[model samples]
Target: MVEGEGVTARQASFGGRGARLLLRWCAVSCWLVVPIPAVVLFTTDVPWWAGVPIQALVLLLILPIGIALWFDADQHREDTGRLLRAGRPAVAEVVELELVDPGDGSADTAVLRLRISGDDVPPFEATYRGSADPEFRPGALLHATVDPADNLFVLRNLHRS
Candidate 1:
């Protein structure tokens, strides 16, 4: 989770690539779903004056939602790339954990408060969802990375050996 500086970037509990794909699909679907029926209705039965305004209203409502999803996906992609390319390893102790039940019968998620150990790095928290790992329990040591520019943007490399 990225905090401070007025913009907080939270890493999704789910996989970042999965989230990006879902967002991209949703944005594309919005373009296909909302406008096609709208166009057909306007051309077949609606008057020009009424149809134009209605179309404009619908576009105004949905465009922002689509744009926001796309922007978020793009941001996630950029962050993931950056983290993979330039992130440095740091040992982090699990200081806290909050288990969250998604309520859909999926595995529970653990929200972690990690105290990163090293010089020039500060403690931060991140929420992760998936099957519970005993390695992530409080006081357990885990491998993680901190964004060089902002220590708050910590990325836990779950696959670390």
Candidate 2:
């Protein structure tokens, strides 16, 4: 029942068309998420181009987009929190699991394809890409919370520390 006890699938939110558009915006255009760091260079006392102020123009251009994204992410976080609080319990059976970075020197993580079915909740398949925990084995039944929106679910109580 405690929050974030288990490894939750962050990809659950990337279910619909919105995420694809977000990815496209970040990839094809390079307009939205890429300018955040360039804008930072202007804020520091460090000389822009050692004499030229190229960073100034870049900052002026990208600051607006950064602000917009920051506000958007903050609001989305709030909304997701609300849904998780009101979510219903469900069980997810891992149909497949694959570790993406086994020896890459990063944290143990994997992509999990799970089939979710619960009482009064329609069955659906979701691919979860996150921390690779021992609890998430193929055919393992994991606990989760089904969002009222019926599209996303958060895993819980996997390996509480």
Evaluate all candidate structures by whole-model CA lDDT and list the values in order. Answer: 0.66, 0.62
TM-score of 2: 0.55
Choose the strongest candidate by lDDT: 1
Question: Residue by residue across 20-139, what tens digits does model 1's lDDT show?
Answer: 899999987776656864777756976777767777877887777888878878887877776666666667777888888989998887787766644434445545444577777888
Q: Could you tell me every candidate's TM-score relative to the true structure? A: 0.62, 0.55
Query: What overall lDDT, based on C-alpha atoms, would model 1 receive against the true structure?
Result: 0.66
Most accurate candidate by TM-score: 1
Off by over 4 Å in 2: 1-76, 102-104, 157-161
